[model samples]
Target chain A: MDDATLVALARSGDGDAFGQLVTRYRRAAFLVALSVIGRPEDAEDAAQEAFLVALERLDDCRRPSRFGGWLMTIVRNRSNNLVRREALRATEQIPFSARSSTPTPEKEAQLSELRDEIARALGELPEVQRQIVLLHDLEGWKHREIAQRLGLPAGTVRSHLHYARKSLRKLLKPGE
Target chain B: MVDNGSIPLELLDPGNSDPGHWARFQARVMALAGPELARRRATRPLTVGEVLASWWRLLVPASVVAAAAMASLLMPAETTPGAGIAIEEALVAGVDDEPLPAVLVADQVDEVAFLVAIEGGG
Candidate 1:
């Protein structure tokens, strides 16, 4: 069934509808959490919490068609909060990679050297810039959509994207 | 729509990259998110209905108390002390030792219409 149907059913005390809704979006929700928080466990937590919040507040959804984005925003905000807390911990740990676990050669080589480089480059970007890049390039969100979701001016979003990609290109250029 | 426009095509495409780029990303993403999902499930908060149910349970006793208070207010006052004493006294003095009090004055109770009629007849 469509998300709208599932959401409506879930609102009427149907647990099955809610379960279906969770299954359908769990992957994307996870990805969104991972990107924002950079830790697998934290991302999973954030995603699940977002889903539960969505379910609990299902009635507050003004546009049922926009439920996915609405739900994701909850995850994004929660993950961001964690990220901020960790940053305040006075350590510069990489997001999402295991703590105390060094990168293995095989794992490093799985992605093409350039792709790996680009990925690392993305990780290195400032938070807002990286978000802009990910929303535009990976998540396929339109600039306007990203602006609305991130609560930034469209021009600011475009500027962030422009600088982020340019900086990434320079950082990921051949031979370093 | 492979239009790179002014952008470099190489940035978007890695000729030697893993053939399963999307799949690999999907795996990493899921792995990273699994535990988060579990935590979220564990901490699932109460819904609106649950909240309302709890609230109603709390209100029921309050409503009952309020109703009792209102009923007490609307009821008539207890019998006056003087009237109660009169009834008890009349019961003791009456023929059967139990008065069927009718709330009558002392004059009404003392009336002797039958005695007066007998005297006139004589």
Candidate 2:
């Protein structure tokens, strides 16, 4: 069934319906969480937490078609909250898996640096700006949809995007 | 600034556009959501002990307060040589006059779910 139908059923106390809804959006939700937290385990934890929160408050969802964005907003909020509370703990540096022996260390090192730069740029954006960038550019969200999901005016979404881009531009400038 | 039908590519394009980014992100997402897809029901079933343990968290505190209230009721008059406040007398009398309330099973079930739900994943 489509997400709207599942959501309608879910609202009526159907855990099955809610479960289907979770399956439908879990990918986008996980990615959003990962994009923010940069730690796979923490991303998994935050995404799961977001799902639990969504299940409890399923009735609060107004437009069922907006479920994907709504679910994503939850993960983003949770992941950012996790990062904030953990004080980032340490820089999240995703090391190459020991199981992989394909790429040379030089190539792996460059990739790791790229990963760090991308994550650092993402981390430094203001909350609103970070969320907009992640949802729109990384997550392929449309502006109108983000505005609706976030309860921000369309203009506000655009403004956030503008600032987010400017900040990223400065961060990714050539040579440090 | 070249605009594609009023869409600014600079604004619209992914700053580090690798189109592959979405692909990898999607792959990881699918992996995460895979295990819990079909097993959505709360069917593991809360054991009686589990239920009571869950309930006791709230029940014990509420019971303590209630007991204290009941003890306060039965307490003797404070004005008398050994009597405590009227509230103490009434509290004791109330408990003695009545047994602890029924377990309130339905409300307790709801209480745990409500707690877990609002707090999100443990």
Candidate 3:
């Protein structure tokens, strides 16, 4: 079913419908938060909190059909708030010991390293470029869809995606 | 899509390699939001019928009071006993410009006295 139908069902107390929405948008929310916050752990927290916030304020959502964009706004706001709070706390970086406790399998460790490298590279890009690149490349969203959701022109979205990919390639392979 | 040859863009996707992670994430969000969702549902706007159904007990009596009030207002006012006589006496006195009768001055006019005063005045 479409977002509007799911939103209406969820509003009527259908837990399963809401669960489906969470399942569908969880990654998008997380990626959006990650793009803003720059930390996987903080991004996850922001995304989860955004979902709860969205659930509480579901009635205030004026357009149910554009639930994804609405939820993204919440995620972005929550992530920005987290950033501000973190700034107030003066915490600079996640302590290495705090990232993981148990040793990971070799393959998982390599994948984690690659993920961190990609995150660092993406961090070097402008915020809009990071968002566009992640949504287009990682989330598989079309440029037009991203434009509509972000309220940018489709050509601008495409241009950002192109520059973002170029920058990512350069950052990932400085040796080459 | 611009071809970023061997960019490993898929590696950046959390869901690509670890679907279970996202599943757990979804579950966690649902678990945390369960109460809020229930609250939203509980506080959902009442339909007109539901509102009437819920408040029918109070509403029914209130409606009765309102309707009785409206009926009373719409109906011609009822004159109290002797009120018409007092008004008629006042009108007669008013026409003659005689000293106004004491019944008109006093709070409660003695109906018999008032009739005698009216006869005497006439």
Candidate 4:
């Protein structure tokens, strides 16, 4: 069913309808949360909290068909709140599990530094640009889908991603 | 910017699939939402506990007011309101004259008043 119909049903206390909405948006929600929080567990927590809050305040959603964008706003707020409350208790480093086992200690050390630099760069980006970059580059989401979810123009999403990647490339340049 | 393929964006993605985690997460959200849904039902009556829980913020102040009221009612009237009669005596006479204590009458009054306010405002 469409999100608007599901939202109406959910507002009337339909658990199944809300559950379907959850299933449909869970990935996007998690990705958005992860973009802000930078940890899977924390992102999941924030996303789940967003869902509960959204369900409680479903009647406040003025545009029912735009549920995805509305929910993303909630997710972003929840994540940023979590960050503020926790004061970033967890490091925003992304794990480098794809590294080859045969690397020497010096090479491994360099790779670790590069990973940290990239994480710092991404973390420092504006929240919107960071989310667009992560969704586009990492999850392989189309600009159109990101635009729809984020309530942004497709061109704006592309521009943000381009700038974000450009910044990442400059920050990760070798022999710095 | 030179080729930066050496940096892996996928590493930061936190892979998009995790059925087990999502299931547990959905369950937690529903657990919270289930009671909220019930509490918000316009047609369904809220249980006493739910009502109290929902209005717990007002509980302490109301209780304090009630306690103060009872204390005031039960205390000996150093200065009677009129006819040199204590407030308790007047309430007792107004009722069935069954000699009910002034404190009980005040308690009943408080309960009725509270219920009315709740029904009126809810």
Best by TM-score: 3
Model 4 lDDT tens row, A87-107: 666565443122223445886
Candidate 1, fnat value? 0.00
Candidate 2 at A112: error in angstroms?
2.1
Residue pairs in collision within model 4: none
Question: Please, what is the whole-model Cα lDDT of each candidate in the order they appear?
Answer: 0.63, 0.63, 0.79, 0.75
Name the runs in model 4 displaced over 4 angstroms: A88-118, A138-141, A170-176, B1-8, B13-19, B39-122
Per-residue CA lDDT of model 1 for A99-157, tens digit only, reads 22335477544433434445456667776786677667765678887786567899999
**TM of chain B, each:** 0.30, 0.31, 0.35, 0.24
Query: What is the CAPRI rating of model 3's predicted complex?
Result: incorrect
Clashing pairs in 3: none
How many backbone clashes does every candidate have? Answer: 7, 20, 0, 0
lDDT by residue (A1-176, candidate 2, tens digit) is 98789877665556567666765665557556766776555776788789877766666888787887688778888997888877756575542111222454886566545555655665677666766776777567789977876778999999999888877777666665
What TM-score does each of the candidates earn?
Answer: 0.48, 0.49, 0.68, 0.56
Q: Please give, for residues A1-176, the per-residue lDDT of candidate 3 as tens digits.
A: 99999999898777998998998888778778878888777888999999988887888889998888888889989998998898889867632111233478998787666666777777878878988887887788888878877778999999999999888787777453
RMSD of each: 14.9, 28.3, 16.7, 23.2
Mark the regions of model 1 whose C-alpha exceeds 4 Å error after superposition: A1-5, A13-28, A84-108, A112-116, B1-122
Q: Which stretches of candidate 3 lie over 4 Å from their true place?
A: A91-102, A174-176, B1-4, B45-122
True contacts kept of each: 0.00, 0.00, 0.53, 0.40
Best by DockQ: 3
Model 2 chain B, poorest ten-residue lDDT window?
B1-10
Model 1 lDDT on a 0 to 1 scale: 0.63
For the predicted complex of model 2, DockQ is: 0.01
Chain A of candidate 4 gets a TM-score of 0.73
